[model samples]
Target: MILDSDTTKVISILGNDYTIKAPEGQEQALMDAVTMLKSALSETKRSYPTLIGDRLLVLAALNLCSKQVELQRQHAEELSRYEEQVSATVEVIEKTIAQG
Candidate 1:
């Protein structure tokens, strides 16, 4: 089954057709995720020609999970930096107000 609409998408996985329906306002994100998963699976299969079945799926999942973890770590670090900058700016503003 091909993509029915923006809200409903059908992707072929492991010789089967899986349908995904995105909640309101998240169709694009869901579609992008499906595309990402397809790319990951294709790359995994290419990388390990001898590997198939559950192992291939597991490896692809693991790769995605690892990427998610790395992205989370980067986001946390960036958020911390933004927080520190805000704190410093607030301190300067407070000092100037007190002096005035």
Candidate 2:
């Protein structure tokens, strides 16, 4: 199947086969995401033995979401810090230019 120049690939997670589609040049990223999810599911299953089906899936989703949130927060903080540094440098440059 092709949509907006996307390509389809088959992947298996937990023995279940799935068809995934991604835009051109993004197939590797899509596969990486699948790998991450499979790893998360494995970790969840190992942590909570006896959990199967929806329960296990829910836990894995929660874990993945929590990690994504944390990463977003950290990225925001780093971006803000970078912006501040850039602003300070610009200010210094302006001051030097005005004094020259």
Candidate 3:
């Protein structure tokens, strides 16, 4: 889990170069997520140019959190449907075996 010097990369985001050190297998995915966040921040900057860096980051994080909540809700609904289907199938199997 030690991401040392050689594993760090300088990524440019919102006109700043940030040196990010990610573990060996996670660098690309981490960079991609950063890139997407930067894009969201850039859009926020375009709409509110007077906002400070910290404010922009906060807004971006809020937006990301909202999306995560929405996704979790959807996943929960799907899981519930799957569980219902599994329960119905199990009941049918038990009934059929009892008759056999």
Candidate 4:
């Protein structure tokens, strides 16, 4: 599935315009992500007023990346725990069936 450049939406971040294309049904999600990134950049700029351009963007990107990594780690741990519980449940069911 290929999206044409004409279908791209323009978003502004720190006064710069960016054109982004998303899957047919995910335009809203893409806009939502742009909003989140703009918010993050704005917050970072407020906290460090002296930073500009590349430095500001890099810091914001790093902050977002760190949060994303942490969330993924937590999700992985939760999935592991869920899998363990399911496995124990299956083992108990198998044992019960063997004993019947």
* TM-scores vs. true structure, each candidate: 0.84, 0.84, 0.81, 0.88
List where candidate 1 sits over 4 angstroms from the true fold: 1-7
Give the winner by lDDT: 2
Q: For candidate 2, what is the lDDT?
A: 0.91
Residue pairs clashing in model 1 are: none
Q: How would you encode candidate 2's per-residue C-alpha lDDT over 1-100 as one tens digit per residue?
A: 7447888999986677889888899999998988898899999999999998778879999999999999999999999999999999999999999999
Steric collisions counted per model: 0, 0, 0, 0
Ranked by TM-score from best down, the candidates are 4, 2, 1, 3
Number of the candidate with higher lDDT, 2 or 4: 2
TM-score of 2: 0.84
> Which stretches in model 2 have alpha-carbon errors above 4 Å?
1-5
Which parts of model 3 have CA positions greater than 4 angstroms off?
1-6
Residue 89 displacement (Å), model 4: 0.3
Query: RMSD of model 1, in Å?
Result: 4.6
Candidates 2 and 4, the one with greater TM-score:
4
lDDT of 3 by residue, 3-99 (tens): 3644788887657888988787888898889878988898778878998778888987788888899999999999999999999999999999999
lDDT of 1 by residue, 15-37 (tens): 87889888768988887888888
Runs in model 4 deviating more than 4 A are: 1-6
The Cα error of candidate 2 at residue 6, in Å, is 3.5
Q: Where's the lowest-lDDT run of ten residues in candidate 1?
A: 1-10
lDDT, residue 79, candidate 3: 100
Cα lDDT tens digits for candidate 4, 36-75: 8888899899999999998999999999999999999999
